[model samples]
Target: MTDESAAPVSSGRRGRSGGGADARRAARTATTITQAGFIRRAIKPYEPFTDEQLQLIEDNAEIVLQETGIDFYEDEEAVQMWKDAGATVTQGNEPRRFRLRFPKGLVRSLIKTAPREYVQHARNPANNVTIGGNNTVFAPVYGPPFIRNLDEGRRYATIEDFRNFAKLVYMLPSLHHAGGTLCEPVDVPVPKRHLDMIYSHIKYNDKPFMSSVTSGERAADSVAMCELLFGKDFVDQNCVMTSLINANSPMVWDGVMLGALKVLARANQACVISPFIVAGAMSPVSTVGTLTQLLAEASVGIAFTQLCRPGAPVVFGTFAASMSMQSGAPTFGTPEPAFVTFGAAQLARRMGVPFRSGGGLCGSKIPDAQAAYESANTLWPTLLSGVNFCLHAAGWLEGGLASGYEKLIMDADQLTMFQKFAEGVDFSENGQAMDAIREVGPGSHYLGSAHTQANFQTAFWRSSLADNNSFEQWQDEGSKDIVVRANAKWKQMLRDYEAPALDPGIDQSLQDFIAQRKAVLPDSMS
Candidate 1:
C-alpha cells in the first residue's frame, strides 16, 4: 500500500547504517539492569529436573504415545520415521495414526538458541514488531469452530463468518497482528481453508500475520502460499507469519506438531511453540507445578527447532490457563490465569526467549460487568509485568470460545491503554515540563499556551472511553455505556475502511490463484 503514514522513519536508516550499534548498546545496558532486578523478584531460579524425574517423565511420555497416538500425514518419510522411533505406524486411505517419541536432547537445544528478545519480520521491514522488549503486540483471540455454537465439531463454519471477523480485526487499531483461523469452517475443504483466511487478511489489513498448525503438510503449504502471494523476502523483510504449535505438555512433543515445526524450519518462518498447559489437566494443580511443565515442554519445542535449523526463529509460547474441576474446562480471566501470565513472562526472560500469553479474554459469557473487570484486571497486570506479545486481544467472550464485535472494540481500547503505559515518559531535560508550568502560573490554564498546544497530542492518552466533555453536555448526551460507544466506532470504521493498495500485480496474482483453486472445488462448494 502507498501509505505515506506507514513509511519508514529516516532516523531508522541512520540507526541501521551504524549496524545497530546504538541499539546494541541500549539493549546491553537495559538487559543488565533488568536481569539483576528479575533475580531479586523471581519466585524461583530455573532449575533442571533430577535425572530420575527426567527419566520418569520420558518413560511416561513414551507410554502415552503408545496408548493414545496422534493423527495426520500419509507421507512415506513420516511413516518410516514413526517406525524407526518404535511408534506403531498405521497406513490408511484416510488420515494415518502414529506414535511419537519425546527426545530430551532435542528439547534442550530448541531452548538454548531461542532468542529472548527479537523483532518479527513484516512485508514492510518497518512494520516489524518486537517481542521480549518494551514493545508488546496484541492480536485477536483464535479458535472458535462456530461463532456461537456451543457444540464442538457439530456446527459448520461459513466464509461469511470469516469475513465478518476479519472486518472487525481491520477496524481495531490496537490489534497489531492478525490471529489466523479464528474459526475453522467444516464446509470449507481443509486444504483451502488457510488460503481463504489469508485472502481475508490481505484484503482487510496490512499488519503482522500468523497461522494455525492444522497439520504439518498444511503448515508447509501455508508458508508457500504466503510467499507466493507476498514474495520470497516476505519472511525476512515483512511482519512475521508465525505458526502456532501446541505441545502436549508434561509430554514433550506431539508428532504432528513436530512435523509442522520441521516444515516451518525449511521455510525459515518464525513460529510460536505455544503449549496450552491447563492446570489439573495437562499439568499439576499448583502454579509452580504448571510452570515447570510449561518450561519443560517449551524447552523441548525450542530445542527441536534449533536442531533442525540452527537460529530458526521461535518464541516460548506459554498460555497457561487453569482448569476448573467443577466445569472441567480451561478458565480465562481469573487470578490463576493472570498469575500464570506474569510467571510465564518471567520464565521466558530467564530462558532468553520471547513469551506469548492471552489478553482481554475472560470466561464471561457477554460483554458486561464481568467481561470488563476480567479483561482489565488480567491485561493490565500482564502488560505492566512485561509480557512480550498478547495472542488473544479481541473478539473473545465466554472464555475464548466465542467472538463478539462489540467486545473486540473494547479489547482494542484496552490494548491502546497498555501501549500508552508501556511508553513511559522520558524525564530528560528536554522532556521536563518546568518551563511550560512556569509560563502558565498556578491558577491559570495551560490549555491555550503554545507549549500545551504543541505537546498535548503526544503528552497524554486521549481515551476512547472516558468522557472529556463538560458535565452538562455529558448528561445531555444520554451517558451511553463504553460498549455502545465502541459499537458505534466499529461501524464507522467499517464504512470508512480502505484496503491497502498493494504493489502492481500482487493483488491480481493472489486473486487469480484463489480463482484457480476455487474452480477445482465443486460448483456448489465454490
Candidate 2:
C-alpha cells in the first residue's frame, strides 16, 4: 500500500560485543580514529514517524492543492502552457486558476532524489560551507524592507545603506554566508536590479553567497551573469549559488518563484525552500495545525525540485512565526519562536535535509536589555536541536523589517559563543583527565599543573561579552552597556575593514556594468 516498506536500511549492527571490539580495531587500522569523540557520540536519537502520520501529511497537501490551487504563470505564454497541460482554466475575462495535481509516487521520488546534505563553496576552497551536521551555522543578509513607507519602514533601505551593511558583513567573523543583495537596491530599476546587486556582493565579500530570487527572468539572468564572471561549471564545481523559493501556505507556488527554482536547478545551484507560514494568518492558530500546513507546503516544493532536477541540493527553510493578534503582524521573538526553531530542526533530521532558521531577530526597537534577552534565548533550542544552518543571524530589528549595525555586532558575539557550546566535550585518552588527576593527587590544586595549563583553553567555554576584568580595572575603564560597547565595535570595524582584492579587470568591468545599468533607470527610481 505504501513505499515505506522499501526504505533502505543500514547494514551494520549496533551494540557492544566481542565482534564489536574487532570491528573497532579494524576501523582504527583504516585510519578512522575519532578526535574529540564525545561530540560524535553525544547526538540525540531521532524519533520514529508512523506510516499513518506520513500519509496524513500527503493527504493534507493534496487537499490543499485541489481546494486552494496555487497561483503561477503570471505571464501569458506560461498560462497557455498550463491550459494545454489540462489544468482547469478561466478565460481572460475571469481570473486564472492554477491547481496542481500531485500523485503519491511523485512525493516518494522527490524525497528519495533530493540531497540531504551538501556544501556551499566560497572563493577560498577552505571556506567551503556544509549544512546538516553538528550545529554548523551560516548567516545570510536578511531584511529587504518589503513594506516601505511605515515609520519603521522609512529606514527600510537605500544603496548607500546596503554598501555600508555589506562592509559590516565583510568584517563579521561569525556570519559565514553573504546573502547577495542584502538590501533592496532602490537605485536600479526592477529589470537590472539583480546584476547591480550581485556586483556589490562580489566586490564586497569573498564568502559563500546566496543568489537573489526575485523573479524567473532575473533569476536566469543572475545565474548567467555569475557564469560570465566566475566561468562555466561555477554552479556545479563550486556550489556557488543558493537561491530561495518561498511557498505560500497551506498551498501555493507562484509562477515567478517556481520558474526561479527551474533556473537555479538548471544551473546546478543549491536551493533553500522557505515556506513562510504565519500562524493565524496563512495557517491555523494551533501549533500542530500550523506545522501540518508547513509540511504540506514543503512537500510541494520538494516534489517540484526533484521533478526539475533529481539529486538537487535543497535545504528545508522553515521560517515559521505566529501572527500577533494585537498588531496583526507576524511576531518574531516569543515562546513560539523557540518552538519554530526546535520543531524545524527535528523535521529536517527526520527528512534528512538541512534545516534553515532565523537568528538574532529579537523584534526590539533598539539594542537594549530586551534585545539581548530575546536574542540569547531564541537560539539555544535551535542549537541543541541540531539545526544545520541558521539564517538572519545578525542585523535584524523590529520583527525582521530593519537591520541594525550594533545588533549585528552583538549577534556575531552570540554566534561565536554558541559555536563554542556546540563543541560539546572532548573524549580523547588525555581529555578524560584521569591520568592527570591521579598525578596531581586528589586534594592538591591542579591550577599550577602542566596538564591544567595545557588544557585550560579547551576545558572551559569563553565569552566575548561577559566581563572578566578585575573590579579595580573595570572601575578605572568605566563599565559600559553592551549596546554602547557594540556600537563602538561596529564603528571600529567600519574604520579598519579592508575590501577583499578581486581580479583587477573584473572589478572595473563589474563597476562599469553597474554604471551602465544605473544610467537607464527613470529619474524617480534613481
Leading candidate by lDDT: 2
lDDT of each: 0.62, 0.62
Q: What is candidate 2's lDDT per residue for 1-526, written digit by digit as tens?
A: 1111211111112111234443344334331111121111145523333456555655665565455544553444444544453444444322543454544344544667777777776653444577665546557447555322212433546665666677667667667777765667565566666775676666556566777687776777667556645666655455677767888665666667877887787677877888887778888887656666676677667656666667878888877677789989777667765665666566666677777776676667676778777776666655665666677777666677667767777787777767666655668887798878887997898888878888888677665665688988866877765666776777676666555544434444455656665577444542
Report the poorest 10 consecutive residues by lDDT, candidate 2.
Answer: 3-12
Encode model 1's per-residue lDDT on 86-149: one tens digit a residue: 4455544454433344443433434576566666654434445776555577778787765642
- What RMSD, rounded to one decimal, does every model reach? 9.7, 12.7
- Report the poorest 10 consecutive residues by lDDT, candidate 1: 31-40
Instruction: Give the top-scoring candidate (TM-score).
Output: 2
Off by over 4 Å in 1: 1-106, 116-118, 148-157, 185-187, 233-239, 249-252, 436-458, 468-475, 516-526
lDDT of residue 319 for candidate 1: 74
Q: What TM-score would you give candidate 1 relative to the actual structure?
A: 0.75
